[model samples]
Target: MAKVSFDGTSGFEVPRHVAIIMDGNGRWAAARGLPRGEGHRRGVEALRRTVRAAGEIGIGILTIFAFSSENWSRPQSEIRDLLGLLRLFIRKDLSELNRNNVRVRVIGDRETLSDDVRGLLEEAEELTRNNSGMTLVVAFNYGARQEIARAAQRIAEAVVSRGLSPADISADKLSEFMDAPDLPDPDLIIRTSGEQRLSNFLLWQSAYSELVFMPTFWPDFDRTTLEQAISEYARRERRFGGLAAAGT
Candidate 1:
């Protein structure tokens, strides 16, 4: 509920939590006559930049759509490349992230992942569990619809085991069952590559988030791109289904 201010003459009101759908990797690679894997590699570099920029700009939480459940439907070779990149990123950047006090939180179905992959994710969280700086949420193998269904299943199990009445279920109760209920909902959701839709990222958590679509590809995203999105978010009024303020 607290507001973050940009320390500049722009007087931008930065969002406390920002979620990004990193898209256009393949297109970027294609445009450059390079393999898609190369684009993904560059995308990772952009991620490193964005993370540093977010921390420097006073962002409390940064959630990224790293890999989605539907991404498995892509070519097996591409899937392998993505998983490899994830492994490389964690192995190479985990130490630096911890030293900088960045907390890593992963949300998704871990049961389906290989033991090694799962272990790495667990290690990332454990190593940074006590960090006090910005929290980075990686949505790997995640889908909002599946997350909601999983929460519903847990609620049902609790009702059966604890003899709780079904009437006690509410929106807030359902939210508490989500993967990372302690994390606040996103205040702004940005999709790069000119995408206009969420594409299954943070459906429930983005109910009132300001959406910004950028023509820039994921590999081209930088601090300026992030600032542009934040500036646009500041220019708008979030009514949340109510009337705007009396003054303009």
Candidate 2:
């Protein structure tokens, strides 16, 4: 689809939270006759550009699926490269993000992360903790199933400690146990590379999210593609399991 511009339009509304499944770096590199590592490096660059574009367009919350828990099973060298890229992003872009009032957060388990990566994550989160601007949430070593399991554990603990009954547990209350309980659920999820499956990104939060899947690869995804996705999102009549305008 061709890119669409905001063009000072009044009817278009920006979603409160936008989550993305960034995929197809390897395939993109293969098609271009480039190394896989090169593809990842370029993907990181695209991520930076996308972040800037989102901030420029007033995106409130951008949750990017960076490294999943399943990613750890990849070649150790590739994982090392990804970690190096992450550390580089923090060290190099922390100042830029702070200047733009972009708060950075990693919503994944840190126990498996190397000490250096863990330290960098803490530093980035703490540094941007005071920022009130757009929240950039990165899912590294994150699994939707694991998150739900952890939430279940917390809910059980609450039931025991606060004298709450199991029958009283609700979906809304269960959400409080997940990471970033205060953050609003994702309103839209854009998956590049035309993938239709969620791939364990955000199981609980995307119940009503409008998904925009495009054929473009993750590294090829830029501001223009983002605008197109936003336009499609605006045009869709999201009824949240109900009827749309024609039905009404």
Candidate 3:
């Protein structure tokens, strides 16, 4: 990934990879006495703005928690609306994303999705596969625990069938089996709607990521909110489980 300081902001190193848990769409809609579907529509706009913002700022990768595996339990109407919005996003925005030189990558359970939805996800990735700009990873129907378990299952299978030793499976090797292994680990993670928990977004990948909780809803998020999150990220010291550097 290219190293570009964020507009020469002194004392701040821009994160190479930033992940966001885009929460509170339903809540935002309810507070306004509107249907949850409207909130989701607006969230798509937010995602568009965020992608452009990340690219303009030279961030290498931006991963978003769009939908979790547990979200399947929501109301059937809401699920339909959510899936509809996803389809609309791909059909409407795929060209723009490609024109902007952004690469789209989907990381989640592809097998569980319906045929049409799966096709759309694959289309988004295939259309923008060779873009040179920032990579946008959407974690739809993704759960960290499930992802880790799947990786472990793969490792076990490899050991048994491929003559690979179990002891050779280090953390780095294990991550190769996880989703989006080619993407770098998140340097900073931001969750909106004042949520402090990860909610099973990126458990294994965000092991040492700096976290920021924002009070803004997903529909209201813009480049300013993203910059604020990055600014907050800039204020921290990442020790990666070690002691702080000298001179504080």
TM-score on alpha carbons, each prediction:
0.96, 0.94, 0.95
Question: 1-248, model 2: which lDDT tens digit per residue?
Answer: 12325766555677878999999998999999998888898999999999999988788999999899999889988888888888888899999999999998889888888898889989999999999999999898999999999899889999989998999889988998998898988988999998889999898998989999999999999999998899889888889888877898
Q: Per-residue lDDT for 124 in model 3?
A: 93
Give the distance in Å from residue 145's predicted Cα in candidate 3 to where it truly belongs.
Answer: 0.6
Model 2 pairs in collision: none
Q: Candidate 1 — which pairs collide? A: none
Candidate 3 local lDDT, 70-157, one digit each (tens)? 9999999999999998999889989998999989999988889999999999999999988998889999889999999999998899
TM-score, candidate 3, is: 0.95
Q: Worst lDDT window (10 residues) for model 2?
A: 1-10
What is the number of backbone collisions in each predicted candidate, taken in the order shown?
Answer: 0, 0, 0
Candidate 1 vs 2: which has more lDDT: 1
Which candidate achieves the best lDDT against the true structure? 1
Which model is ahead, 1 or 3, in terms of TM-score? 1
Q: Pick the candidate with the highest TM-score.
A: 1
| Alpha-carbon deviation at 184 in model 1, angstroms | 0.8
Q: What is the C-alpha RMSD of each candidate to the true structure, in Å?
A: 1.7, 2.8, 1.9
Tens digits of per-residue lDDT for model 1 on 71-153? 99999999999999999999999999999999999999998999999999999999999999999999999999999999999
Error in Å for residue 158 of model 2: 1.7
